[model samples]
Target: MPLSEIKIDDEVFVSEGTVGVGAVRQVTPRELTIYIEGYGDIAIGPDHIASAHDGKVVVKPETLPGAIQAHLEHVHDGEYRRPSDT
Candidate 1:
């Protein structure tokens, strides 16, 4: 689904993981930011999204790491990097 279709309050579900459920709190041209109770906000792109409708978004858990990296870079202005990267 296009990011344009996503709206606030949309519920986000991962195919499988401890990610549980999250609610869309903010939307931007690049990603959708969802708030998960215990996990906090996570920024993600549409590539991992399997489908979206009826105020819900289903995503692939495997892409989570890349999603997070995008978030960090977006917010930090390239000041941070994956710890293991040389």
Candidate 2:
């Protein structure tokens, strides 16, 4: 997809072993800079990401205040699930 088509609250697979949803903060022809809820803003190559949305509501973005707690919840809950294979 074109960079103009991407948006905030979109999940993207940056690479194998590097998949984190990004909250779009800025955009450019060659990059889509995003403020990953827990990781802060980082500029990722447009070609390096695979958009993870399929026009379905699988996951939703959280508000800023809820971001921390949600991350904690995911982490806490992760202890019980099998690790993902990159």
Candidate 3:
């Protein structure tokens, strides 16, 4: 599925683990951010997404760690813009 088709509040899932499910919070040219209940926010690349159906996005579980790392790096690099800052 194409990333551009994703909408706010859409659910996201992974092949394994509890990290899979979350609600779409934000989307940027570089990444899509989801707000996982109790887990906070996480970001993943559209390229890592395997499919989208029934208003949900399924991402490759193997790419999760790397996506998380990239998200953290992006935050550390001061590239992330918080909603409050807008």
Candidate 4:
């Protein structure tokens, strides 16, 4: 998704990366900040984001340094997110 489109509380995903999911905490012109359990908050730049689909931002794990460990958060797969959900 476009950086402009991302917002606080939005969900994030990983593509062949460490953190499987993240909760968006902040979005700025430069990057998107997401919080992962046991990992804390992380800022993701556009280059690492693979794509935007189904209202989620998919990021590449390799792009995230020091994110070697792996874990997954609840995604509620296929659950449609409403505008108010953001």
Candidate 5:
């Protein structure tokens, strides 16, 4: 989905690469502003987020230190989910 479709109270994985549930404070062409519970209001560029639906976003488990790194290395190999052409 396009970032324009995201709304308040949406849980998103931000470009900072941290997953958090943030309440949408505002949305503009250049940015999406949200107030995350512990992080306070943070404005992120619209290009820096991907939505997570009901915990369905897949991230390789990071219990081991190298796992997240390995996952990062391969994250761009394919489109995990492609937005529809709508």
Candidate 6:
């Protein structure tokens, strides 16, 4: 299963490690924005997503940090401002 097939509100988890869990908040053609508790919303790309199935999306643990960074860069480029950025 690919990340492109993930549905909104589906539970996502770091299936390979003890990272964290989150819910899919938004989905786009290029990314999946997940609302991770304590970490806020992070957009994950296909490269970071290992698989998605049975109402759960598993992300590659090693790519988690990079995904978060990419999301931050994306948000900074858009009009939406994260609270911590203020």
**Top of the candidates by lDDT:** 6
| Backbone clashes in model 6 | 0
Q: Number of backbone collisions per candidate, in order?
A: 0, 0, 0, 1, 0, 0
Tens digit of per-residue lDDT, candidate 4, span 1-86: 46887768766777533334667898899898888655678777889788755557777766667532344334444447568854
Q: Local error of candidate 1 at 8, Å? A: 0.4
- Alpha carbon lDDT at 68, candidate 2: 43
The window of 10 residues in a row where model 6 has the poorest summed lDDT is 70-79
Model 1 lDDT on a 0 to 1 scale: 0.70
* Candidate of highest TM-score: 6
Give the clashing residue pairs of candidate 4, or none.
17-61
What is candidate 3's CA lDDT for residue 36?
Answer: 51
- Candidate 1, run of 10 with poorest lDDT: 69-78
> Mind giving the per-residue lDDT tens digits that candidate 5 earns over 1-86?
35556655555443335544445677676766766444466576534454435532222224223633354445445546678999
TM-scores of the candidates in the order shown: 0.65, 0.43, 0.60, 0.65, 0.42, 0.66
Better of 3 and 4 by TM-score: 4
CA lDDT of each prediction against the hidden true structure: 0.70, 0.49, 0.66, 0.67, 0.49, 0.72
Kindly report which residue stretches of model 4 are placed more than 4 angstroms away from their true locations once superposed: 16-20, 68-86
> By summed lDDT, which 10 consecutive residues of candidate 5 come out lowest?
55-64
Worst 10 residues of 3 by lDDT: 72-81
Q: Which run of 10 residues does model 2 get worst, by summed lDDT?
A: 55-64
| Tens digits of per-residue lDDT for model 2, 1-86 | 46766665555433334444445677687776666545577565644454434421112233224654355245334335678998
Measured with C-alpha atoms, the lDDT of residue 23 in candidate 6 is 84
- Per-residue lDDT tens digits of candidate 3, residues 1-86? 46777877878766433234567888776788887544577777877788776668777756667655455333334335468854
